[model samples]
Target: MEKQTPTLESSSQPQLKLAYLRPGDMIDVEFASATKVRTKLQLVGFDTGRYLLLKQPNPRTEGSYADVLFEGNPVIVRLVLEGEAGECIAFKTKIRAVTNFPFRLLYLDYPEQVENRALRAQKRVRTHIPVDVTADNNQADNTKKLASGVIVDISSAGCRILFKAQNEGGNVTHMNIKVSIGSGSQKDLLMLSGQVMNQKKERGMISVGVRFTDEEAHIIEVFDHLLIDTEFEC
Candidate 1:
């Protein structure tokens, strides 16, 4: 795609806002100059308002561009947009600020598998989840160790989770988990085993997708309840 740079005058600053954003949705932004600005924008810290820090590339964008560059860094952006209609509209002026509406995080309302089966002929559900991951190699030892990860999404057959690398060799195949669900009185925790199916890198993090083993039917049943009974009011 052709990149463009924004024309910023001394008195006027570029207005920036996050338009059409959702919690799990991916977005792309560009400058008016057609320079194809590249940076890692994180939904990191949020106050009553949504604030973002643009981790500018080293060496920075030079010249009389947006006073965007300060102390060898790009100006941090504070964005606020609404979650309604799956859009977060943003604009900028001299003092950069997001417009349109206030931004809120979104969670999928329905099961991803159901949505996928209806939309694609292949009937595959591929969604990413954020998790804390780890691995252990001493299976024969008496110690019972566990790796922790959050269930990103669940289907009738499989699930995906994010986790930290347990070993340097990257030869993880089998794993055990103790998953805690709900909170307080209704909270439930279960132990299960699964086989790692794939691994990929995202935003400098390693994510592992797993398929539950045959012996873990009970764990799958609990997932079914969580996916079906929970009413997500996004």
Candidate 2:
């Protein structure tokens, strides 16, 4: 059975609206079958109002999903939107074709409509605050993967950062967030631990959503600064 989703404007709850998705966006695909197979696919390309083209998952890692990916097979597609628009978008469609000539690809019928659900609990305020993020991949090793970015929007619960990927050769998906509040002698280094919730990469820049863990007290001042800055800007 397919999951029923309400329209964006029909409910006062978190609205799910169609977002302008990019080519490399990652989306989850769930088949409406007995096994109910689910997998992740990258958006290769698409024809507006016609169909969506997705890169088929690697056969070695995903096994051969040939049977489950047949034509006319129903599938549910879900994707997350980070940044200021924090929500999840879902739609139901059927596989139209699968090709493996130049590259393996899965074609899906265009959905008539899509449903979105808000993912953020607290509202976020927009701001630009420089911060350094460090990714500790191995606890036993001393190797540190560091990247510098600015917090674009934030709340007490979570925040979004925009930055250029460092040559450190790994994604800062789950990293420790270090933010500097003041300048010079009065500078306050607020260290907050967080897990990367969602990330989007476009061009050479990346946007990531991070949820703080047990750092409400440390973020109060930062949040207050953002609130005041927002008020001043308005």
Candidate 3:
């Protein structure tokens, strides 16, 4: 896949908060007006400190909010960073421009500052656990496919898994998957459900980051067992 390099802004603004964002990431935009409209839009591109470009909301679905999308309107933007750096970022800016000629697009003034909060309260612990991960394919058929991988590190919130690229194809974001722990008998298998948050592919292998939707108690149980096993072997 060809990665798009975001347009770099001038050096005048040393602290470019929006530089961390990428095209196609979902952003929550709140128009600070009488109606206080809030909606989600996919990021189209950005020019560092100059402007943040976003795909205009679909006319058929989100045309109602067009009234609040005028120039100089105050806007609050937010996006969540998944994977190792789990954080939610928010910034304040204004609608810089809006266009519908060639394409429907919305532009906002580059934020001067950004605020972020950590999503994971607990620190991640490093370990290796053999497992089987079954991810839902992004097709109309809704097939369940399995892959053998190793959970390289984990925390109460999520974990990172390493598996061969041939095991699972394409982007796995938002795909429902189950991490099966243990082996041999059916009773020995401990299944944990989660959605694929992010992935990195290199050297014929892919690293998957997953945030578990299972209860904290269950995660703690697995965490304790893994830790104890590690200590015993040490």
Candidate 4:
């Protein structure tokens, strides 16, 4: 059997009337709070009914704030964009934070969908990609300066890391995280400043959620290529 080739849609014309979002576009959302929490969300699915389905980059445990409703409404969110040609993209589905607390901001990737027309129909394509990560903890003892942790997963804006720590120290809400991407021969490293958005303590295990800073927006492209390539390869 012959391998099927994927089709590329024209990028010249804009399909959807979405604000700050285009198909295959990744963006970060910031929340208002003391911690300045943020999460990574991916635009996996969409509904023309003024809403889109955003997949949470991390998984949440039971009885967590992510399980509860936001603003007295369900955890499902809708993007209410303002300005000329305002539009609303509703996400009627529930999302789990993969963490314990709620982060104020979220990073999201919007994928475009094709609409069926008189002569052409829409089809779904898969892409595959990979991400590289490096995290460090400055709180380690003075003599032993080392950061210990492994990234659980990553999206366009942020990532979830699993670290081993016994307790929280004083004045340490942010950490230095580095991420990179590339295939066998080509690799690119990106340095980002992140803050601890949420912490979960269980015995000897600690999971932390972190979001990228405004200056780190450039890294989203590396992540997007990894995701899209990974999907296609798979």
Angstrom error of the Cα, residue 142, model 1: value is 3.9
lDDT of 1 at 186: 35
What does candidate 4's lDDT look like per residue over 1-234, in tens digits?
A: 332222223222336445444343332333223333344455544545335444444444322234222332222233433222223343322222222245333222333442212211211122232333344554333222224555565544455655566455322346554434444534544344466665554457655556666354465555444443212111
Q: What is the TM-score of each candidate against the true structure?
A: 0.33, 0.79, 0.67, 0.31
Task: Encode model 1's per-residue lDDT on 63-159: one tens digit a residue.
Answer: 3334333222222122233211112233321212332224422111111110001111112233343233334343535433344555655544455
Best by lDDT: 3
Clashes of each: 28, 1, 0, 16
What lDDT would candidate 2 get against the real structure? Answer: 0.71
Candidate 1 positional error at 4, Å: 47
Give the C-alpha lDDT of model 4. Answer: 0.40
Q: How close is candidate 2 to the true structure, as a TM-score?
A: 0.79
Which lDDT values do the candidates have, in the order given? Answer: 0.37, 0.71, 0.74, 0.40
Clashing pairs in 2: 16-116
What does candidate 3's lDDT look like per residue over 1-234, in tens digits? 332222223222333346657677779987765544778999999886588899888979767666676898787787876545457777777899999889989999988877776677755567678998876444537656568899887777788899888843788877788888894444577778888988766678888889898887886776565552212110
> For this target, which candidate reaches the highest TM-score against the unseen true structure?
2
Q: Output the worst ten-in-a-row residue range by lDDT, candidate 4.
A: 115-124
State candidate 3's TM-score.
0.67
Q: Model 3 segments beyond 4 Å from truth?
A: 1-17, 126-130, 135-143, 148-153, 160-176, 181-221, 228-234
